[model samples]
Target: MSNQQPGWFPDPSDAKKMRWWDGNEWAVHVSRDGAVWEEPLVAKTIGLKRRSRWVWVLLALGLLVAVALLSPLVALVALVVLVTGIVGISKGSGTWLRLKSRRTAIGVTAGAALVFLMAGSVSAAMVPGETGAPTAVETAQSAEARSEATPRRTSTPTPTPVTTSREEVVTEVIPFERSTVEDANIARGETTISVSGQDGERTITYVVTVVDGVETGRELKSDVETVAPVTEVTTVGTYDAPPEPAPPAEPTCDSNYADACVPIASDVDCAWGSGNGPAYFDGVAKVVGRDIYGLDRDGDGLACER
Candidate 1:
């Protein structure tokens, strides 16, 4: 094995696996059946190994270069490694330390320090210098220079002229006229419409003045009757009726006669007795006063007695 070149060789601890040997030492990289993985070489004794200070210095330089070219995640990994190394050194023994080696502790601490230093250097390099940033006065001067480079022209707006226009408009309206007629058949003070009146239409023209889409004024241009107005006819009643004849007066008995209602006529006689008469009296008649009808022939006041 000492004379063999750096290559995959059979693992000493496990014959079924193959391990990688660098020029100086065995690497943690291993492979089996074409598959590759990492596994630290087991130490024969659980004792710490001694390493020269130069090894630690070289590892620190390598980590610094890696951190400078890689991302911040690499820096964080280095910090964890450094913390683990410190804790292991304080406890004098730690399960995390491979082979419990003091050399690994020193290498991790130095590498973490170098990584931080390189990260700070990279940050400082990316920052802009004071002279590189523009000041307020310089910015103003540059803007003035740009303004002077181009000449600006001022534009004036033209005023709009006020215009007027006239438009003719035609409108239609309904109109009607009413007139009365005398009718003999209708009674006086009682009128009735003989004919139904209808509405008529008239057309009118107007001239309007408009300025800038707005109406200013309008004037009557012409008016013409399109349809003649219909006249409304009204009938009035006028009738005079003749006076009615008075009813006949009731006949009354003469005051000169008593105990009988004698007929008031030019001549009267007893109902069944004999005498020329225009009227007759039933039963006998007695006269208390003058006998106007001559119903009593005796001179006594009481005539036709018994």
Candidate 2:
């Protein structure tokens, strides 16, 4: 649509290439190959000057066809494009009638726009929400309505209640896990080994079993994962201890000897001795049950014999 220079001229550097000047007394040319120049189309006629002018007709036709095939909503959009194309096609040139001011062209465009929009709206409104069937909301409403419309049937099918005996209900027996054993040199007395876990506590009543610090049986009341349930565990020992040698009859001095040689079972070499002792190394005797006592000092709870 633009050329500022005059007629065709050979580009000084190349004979095949060309430069042109517009006819409005500017320096330009009219040529594709300077060998045979093309006469420039005058800009006075809008459509004749540029390739874009031709596109409007094509665009308007395409839009018109689109409007016909699509729903009103989409058709409305195509219609706007078609009308705008029509105005642009006029090219603002004076026709057989008169030249149109840009403003007048714009107004004409807007008017055509309003008309098509109205047509599209009217058409879309008639379209149904779905395939004529009600939506979930509507279907629910209809079902409710039918329920109210029908008369109530007082007698209905009654389901028989089935009873199951304890033996019939297959029980899921829960297995117990023994936590890590926490053994240590325990003083001679009753010690509570923490029997934790829900199932452990529940089945862990009076008869809670502990085989080598492991729970063999228990009823867990809570989930096995949480809750601090106390478990009664009995750590039965392999050996037992007897009552302390009845406070040995008062140690007596040998009638002719300077001091009493009567044996005094002092807990030396035992945990009570803090390294300070008569230095006499002996053995240890571990007692387990209430009535059992042993004198085997090598951690072997036995009686009498060292």
Candidate 3:
């Protein structure tokens, strides 16, 4: 019958234990393995007999009678005592008395009813509306519930700013220039360096600004240190050339062929012939190659005509 009521019963998940059924649904509280009820730690194994409802009814009747006869103070004290006894018997003795015997269970419930009647008489003697406050335990539990329901607070973080700079080095070439000067001693179309040219050098430093690990701005910080340039001197050839020696005189044809030449036209002068006055030749073969005297009547290389 108690199991059929709107309360707890042995859990289906664990047959040896009890779980709370809060009238409409099962609650989170569950008993240990051998427990018969789910409740406060000290009373979890105790079972409240369904008949305990009769104890509360008896308490109410006793309180009514005491309030009508005795004062309100007496009635209030009696009310407190009755409520305490009912809770203890229902939670502590209910399961134990029932399991031992039905007779024992009935005896305990009747005894608690009688105690409530006796205390109700004394509480009814107190003044009306002057009942004592709730017990310390109930007040403490209320405070604990309020604390758990309240939310906690958190702090906000602040941001910090930063400044940064960077330095970098780079190099570049300075070109050297060539300079020319006239040199009459040098030959034309020829180049000679009176002084060799040299390239100039320089170095510079800069200050650069960076933000969040990235470059943002830059400026020159140091004056450029420069090496002065050495002026180059190159001699361009401007010398005039001496006139080429007069080409040698051409040789004369008379000098190259003097053996064949004749200044006097005498037949004796003919070197190829031996005759003198007539410049005669017995045969043309005898006058071969000696016509310088012009004594040949025909060009047969003969000296004279027949």
Candidate 4:
């Protein structure tokens, strides 16, 4: 029988019921006339223990129901405790007779009871006065009805004004420019102003935004040149004068003789005739002015006659 595979088998104490064999021992589950239910094998012999288990189960169920009606949070906690207790007891001992398992069950039952009590207290605190007291909606409606029976005066609020204006023209100055031009008529290294510069004017249009009588912002709408600017013209001299002619060179010959050159020396004579001299003139010579050389013998205008 110890080596037999797990299966349903006839109960040793009852012929009408079949008990599940879990290979190691008889399981707590039994079927009678094809209807299955969990029943400890020792339940028949210990009726007192069975009754005590029913009492605990019934008490936990009652707590769960009561908490569920009062608060869902408490109800969820009670459900978890109940499931944990059932599992712990089931796994501890088949008959729930172990001291530790019984203590666990009792603790779970007590925790559920505490949660139910707390939920009840919270539910009672939420409602003011007694059970016959008016609800929150009823109280609010009564207050509203009482206020409607009377009226009070209220002041009207003043409004702020915002204004937008377009095409607001603003004038601005446009400075003149200066330019240079080369003139050949003027002397070199000299400069003179041809046209005096005059400043110009321009007008700018804008879209202005004002809030509460104060200017907030403005956007450029258009720009127009009211007066054209005059450009100052400067004349720079580029003319250079031609160089002067060089002075005439001095004459090399003497200016005393008119016809031929007569050598100016201590004594001058003709070259063809006999005249002992260091310097001599061979050509015929004539004296227009005083004869400086005294070469003429007959006092004629001729000297060194040949």
Question: Residue 54 lDDT in model 2?
Answer: 57
What is the C-alpha lDDT profile of model 3 across 182-227, one tens digit per residue? 8888898898788877777667678889776777889987756477
Please give the range of 10 consecutive residues that has the lowest summed lDDT in model 1.
43-52
Q: For residues 163-228, what per-residue lDDT tens digits would candidate 1 score against the true structure?
A: 676757575756666778776666679888877787877778787877677888889888887887
Q: Which candidate is the best by lDDT?
A: 4
Query: Each candidate's root-mean-square deviation in Å?
Result: 31.5, 31.3, 24.5, 25.1
Best by TM-score: 4
Estimate every model's Cα lDDT from 0 to 1: 0.67, 0.42, 0.54, 0.71
RMSD of 3: 24.5
Greater TM-score among 1 and 3 belongs to: 1
* Candidate order, TM-score descending: 4, 1, 3, 2
lDDT of 4 by residue, 1-306 (tens): 689899999986676899999998888989987799998786467777778789978976776576656664774565445444444444453233234557767676457546645564566676556476444335334544554543544578988686866558899999999999999999899999999999999999999887877888899988899999999999999999999999997664335666787766776767876778787778877777777666676877787664
Residue 121 error, candidate 2, Å:
7.9
Worst 10 residues of 3 by lDDT: 253-262
Candidate 1 Cα outliers beyond 4 Å, as residue runs: 1-155, 159-168, 253-306
